[model samples]
Target chain A: MKGFKYLRNVTTLKMDSGKCINCSKCIEVCPHHVFALNGDKVTIINLDSCMECGACAKNCPAAALHVDSGVGCAAGLITEWLRDHRLLAKVECC
Target chain B: MPRISADLTFADRLGSWRVRWGIGRMNYIVPPGLYAVGRPNSDSPVLVTANYKKSYDSVRSVLAERDCWILVLETYGINVWCAAGKGTFGTEELIRRIGASELTKVVSHRQLVLPVLGAAGVAAHKVKKETGFNIRYAAIRAKDIPQYLDSGMRTAPAMREITFTTWERVVLIPMEFVEALKPTAIAAALLFFITAMLQDRNAGFLAVCGYVGAVAAGAAGTPLLLPWLPGRSFAFKGVLTGSIWSIIFYMLAGGSGWSRFMALAAFMILPAVSAFYALNFTGCTPFTSRSGVKKEMKVALPAMACALLAGIAIAITGMAI
Candidate 1:
């Protein structure tokens, strides 16, 4: 995560500060240290560092965090696209 | 109250090796339930993990000296990180496992130490509400579990961090190489036959070997030299290495009499295939994201296809000439 910086602003990770309980679950669970406790609120300290693994969103007690997370495999995406277009009857492979 | 041993036998190492080589991958699973690691007692800490044998073995091997209960959730043989991503290692499974194993009856403490990576699937609050057990997200790696437990059940900052060292990258190469075998073989055979039809058998054999080299450079070499590679995008780094390999291959394989079209084709095809394979390796990496891979595919896929097609067309034209 230190040397690698992928595309910017591509992650769907968002936090609802209004619903945040300041549990710091996001801060604790994030592998990339993307979240930080700011006073009484949790803030996205480094959005770019988020790989969207959905740990924060899944563990959030108050349902304050959201992200569309999945495997980042190109072959998986191609198969999904093929399935969507009805080009492949059944697609498998991760 | 099923007692399980913590010492890893030779059989365990062999089994893990077989799985790493892509053998018995689907069936490489341990039964999902509670097991005692190192003569654990009710007062000992409980650690939640996946049912994958590799994951189980890794966790238990590290706790050889510590007395602990391992609560393995059914993940259908998938590793904790991937299974958690798929939600198989989620709250429902944890609750189900806890209830089935009668964990409360066996363990005095209500705290379950979960791998930090598994935080993706589990919610501490929901599990607490459902099972009355608090989920404590622990070390990212099982090797740190001893220290974590020793330090008053607290994970040090180093324990929480994930670092992909050269050895970490190297260990993944065997599986990557195994996965590439079929495709590389097929491509090599196809290239051999096609080039034999166009030129001579000697030319075909050399071309096939060259192509295999390119594929290996992409699939294995790129990952081994990841940090030092030139570009941020894996595709670019692959192509860079690929181009260098292609040129060296051409010179070594006696390209003096090769038509300009053949040279062009070699340059284009080798790098294109290498880039494609390298780009696919993004999925295997620790840091790559779905969004980043999607962005890369959107741009690189079409380009790879075009380059490959053009290279083939030029190769045929050169042969005809």
Candidate 2:
């Protein structure tokens, strides 16, 4: 994390602190340590560290977190686009 | 229950090496089912993992001198993290696997220890509700498994954090190298003949080597020097490496002999190639997010395409004269 940092202000991750049940479920699931408990609610500690893998959002019982999760590979995105456009005969992520 | 050997055999080692270089990589999978690693009783720990041989191998090899039940989930040969993201390693699969394997009968405890990376696909509460198995995310990497088990299954902070060390980057280089091999070869072949006909044999060979170097810089160099490389965007990092490659190429190829326009062409085209390779590496890295990569591609891809086309157009126009 010290060396590997991706584009800042690009992640779609959003946190609704008011809706947080203080379960700390997001904190436990987030691999990037993107969330922290500020008082009785969950807060985004480091938004840049959020890879938007969607573990927190999926695991959150209160539905307080949101992020459009998907594979973040250029090649994978291109393949997705091609598949959407019907350009590729077979769409493969790898 | 099938008993698995924690110690890897020569064939297993060879298979791993082959897959690391992208040989039979897609099909490199173990059968999806429950297996006993070491003599295990009902009270032994149950660790869940993907059916990908690499994932399975990493987990088991670290578990030597320990007794456990490994519950292998079918992930179509993809690694746990990737499979989880794609939903092949999701709740449905986990629940189904548990039922199919008769997990309840085999193990007295209703706990399933899973790798933390696989958390993306699995919902812990849901799994617990559906199958009555308490999901325990033990560690991010297999190397940390021993510590987790020995220390009363406690997940230390370091066990959860992902580290992309130099050796980790080095190992991934081969796959990137192999992935870029075909395209690089074709482009180099075409560049060699075109440059030879347009400029001279000497310049053609130099151009080909330069192009190859750009690919290496993007695929290998950028990753190795990732932290040291400037810029957050993978494309930007690649461009820096490619620019360096271009400069080094000019010096090595004797820029004095090549025409000024041809030199310009190499500078434009080679770096773009490097950027492309570097951009492709987002798939290999752990920290890169889908949203961030999408934003980067919107700008980087068009710029690279334009650079490539302009460099080719300039070379042709200059060569005609």
Candidate 3:
């Protein structure tokens, strides 16, 4: 945990202000404080800090938020890639 | 007791099959679309989830006595977090499942509660646009569901927290050990054989011991002693522990007169091996972030490589002398 920094730029989380009803649901739900409210509008202050957990998008009533979230583990990714490439069977452990 | 017995028997069969064929099947199929539980009424709360059997079972088993309607989306046997990351657990799937199951007719209410972790994949707005159903993200774990339902569907402070207690950490060890066994055994055996050829045949015992110690220090010690360890970095903690073990082994094995080079080699190699494996343990921890892990790897990996190279050089020089 100390040496490795999380790979954060891969997220697809986006906030559309037009769809945002200014609901603070995203703010309350985020474990990483990825969003903050600015005068009835939600903004992504720390996109890189996001683990892509999708808490905000799930709770957003206005449907203004979107993100690409998933397990970021190397083992999980390798297995997924292998399965996708048909190099390995659909197995839980790699 | 009877249910527990049945569950145990089923788990045994699954485990044996998994071991024999090397095909992990613990998380298999789950029926997609909305399912009623315990004769739920139209007004029952709709809980949405991925079609991963483990996730489905965890939710259903927890809510056994309660009446509810489960809306399971097609996640292709992936868990919520992974499915969300891959977009299999996203807005399109939710909308498609809703239409396919005619969920609107099953439930009188328009609100659907989903796992908080599923938010990454699902676009709440898209689901609403397609099905007119509002999404409510629940607490992190399914165990808090009964309380959430009782408390007007509001997540309490306790419910929101994710804990990695000792028991939880311990449970993770088995899977870690299982995953590591193949590589660890192969490496240990190769080292054992090589050591036997280079030195006394009994040297294989030392080699196996060293390899096993490195694995245990990295995989088991780091997680169990996570909070107590001196460093914030897992690799550092592992290296530190490994260094201590190497010193203890050196003292016990009476390797003092062997050479200064071998002493240095032992110190370098053991810790580097431990560090690499410990860094890999980040994937298993809960509090680790993607950015945090990447940063650790950048610094730790180079140090590990350097140490390993230095160790190899020292060992070769000692052997030649």
**Residues A1-94, model 2: lDDT tens digits:** 6678998998899878778788887777778888878877677889999998888887777888899999788888998999889998887766
Candidate 3 shows a clash count of: 26
Candidate 1 lDDT over residue span B229-314, tens digit each: 86668888789878878988888988777889989999999999889878888878877788888888888999999999999999
TM-score (chain A only) for the predictions, listed in order: 0.91, 0.90, 0.83
Largest lDDT belongs to which candidate?
Answer: 2
Model 2 residue B259 CA deviation (Å) reads: 1.5
Off by over 4 Å in 3: A1-21, A32-71, A74-94, B1-23, B251-258
Model 1 chain B scores worst on lDDT over the 10 consecutive residues at B155-164
Error of 2 at B179 (Å): 0.9
TM-score of chain B of each: 0.97, 0.97, 0.88
Residue B11 of model 1, lDDT score: 98
What range of 10 consecutive residues in model 3 chain B has the weakest lDDT sum?
Answer: B1-10
Q: What are the runs in model 1 whose C-alpha is more than 4 Å off?
A: none
* DockQ for all models: 0.73, 0.80, 0.26
